[model samples]
Target: MTEALGTRTITAAVLVIGDEILSGRTKDKNVGHIAERLTEIGVDLREVRVVPDVEEEIVAALNGLRHRYTYVFTTGGIGPTHDDITADSVAKAFGVSIDVDPRARAMLLEYIAEKDLNEARLRMARIPAGADLIVNEVSKAPGFKIGNVIVMAGVPRIMHAMLEAVLPTLDTGPKMLSETILANAKEGDIAGPLREIAERFPGVSIGSYPFLSETGPNTNLVVRSRDPELLAKAAREVADMVAARQPAA
Candidate 1:
């Protein structure tokens, strides 16, 4: 669901597609990068899903995410191989036809020689109908945007370039403000009061993350709100709770 503060929340989801990722052969590095980049631009990354190279699975996940969120960013399966089926799957998901676009071919020709652009390599030029290309500066193979779904490359560098190229075209909301209070106490120690504080500030989001410190287990209380005043107020209350929970010297 899109989070609401004062303005309408712009939400997005990430769909990671690759057999290698699901089989644990390739570790995902795009989700976190996408999350951070979107957050920086005031877009909330609501959900993330990883699916294999199967077309039906990708189509299902793409349709599901496209209808649910404002935007769906997909990584992988757009390469120059039989398994690179993201473009076709996205076309199927949108009920559109897929074909090699002259525009995409031109982009590829910037790097790949025309004679050397074999059948497999030409696969990179396939794009869904009515979709805009997301330029890939690193590699000439372009990503594409169809409806709300953005199909990007799986390689971290290429994906990063595509995301950068697409970010300017997206709508963003007010940035989410956050403050962290190092509550040098266990999560259990502050759960009760934290709940009370959270209830008091309906607009603020309170999260308690537990970690092991040199002494023992401790909790980090993060207070988040779009409004600076509200964030400061919630942070003060959280700090007070942490101080109260602290042992006297």
Candidate 2:
């Protein structure tokens, strides 16, 4: 089912595809970068899943995410090697034909000579039918956009570049505003009041992060809301509550 855009609260998901990532051989640096970038643009990244190089897993994950979110960004598995099966898996998910696209081939020719465009190298040019190309600045190999899924390289530098190129074209909503209050009390001590505050402001989201400081147990209460006025109001209430909880000096 196709969803109508132009609505507030745009959401997205990230699908990390690689056997190396699943095995912990390669540390993932793309998810955090993508999450931060999306948050800045008001696109909420709601979910992230790391799948291996298996075709069925990729296809299943892609289908599920694409249907549930506004956009699905996938990283890795679109290279020349045999295990780089993202393109093929995406094609299967979308039920589209996979072939060496002339435009993608042309993009490759700019970097590689015709004589050197071997079958292995040409594998990068195999794009799904009816998908638009995402220009990669760091490398000539282009990522692609099919339906709501945007596929990019797994490398940190290249993924970052492709994300920059693609983000501007995506739909966005009002950026979520946040304010943090330091609760000089333990999370257990503040749970009741925090729950009350959270219940009071259904529009605002309150997150309690507990950490140990030299001073002793402390909790950071983060309040987030799309509306600035609501956010401020909730933050003020939270601050007041925390102040009341603290002992007088």
Query: Model 1: per-residue lDDT, tens digit, 1-249?
Result: 225465888899999999999899999999999999998999999999999999899989988889999999999999988888889999999999989999999999999998999999999999999999999999889999989899899999999999999999999998888899999888997799899999999989999999998999988899988788889999999999888877898
lDDT of 2 by residue, 1-249 (tens): 112233577899999999998789999999999999999998999999999999999999999999999999999998999999999999999999999999999989888899999999999999999999998878789999999999999999999989999999999988877899999889999999899999998888999999989989899999988878888999999999998977889
The local lDDT score (0 to 100) that residue 96 gets in candidate 1 is 91
Candidate 2 C-alpha error for residue 44, in Å: 1.4
Among the numbered candidates, top lDDT falls to 2
Q: What value of lDDT does candidate 1 attain over all alpha carbons? A: 0.92
Residue 242 Cα positional deviation in candidate 1, in Å, after optimal superposition = 1.3
CA lDDT, every prediction? 0.92, 0.93
Worst 10 residues of 1 by lDDT: 1-10
How high is each candidate's TM-score?
Answer: 0.95, 0.93
Pairs in steric clash, model 2 = none
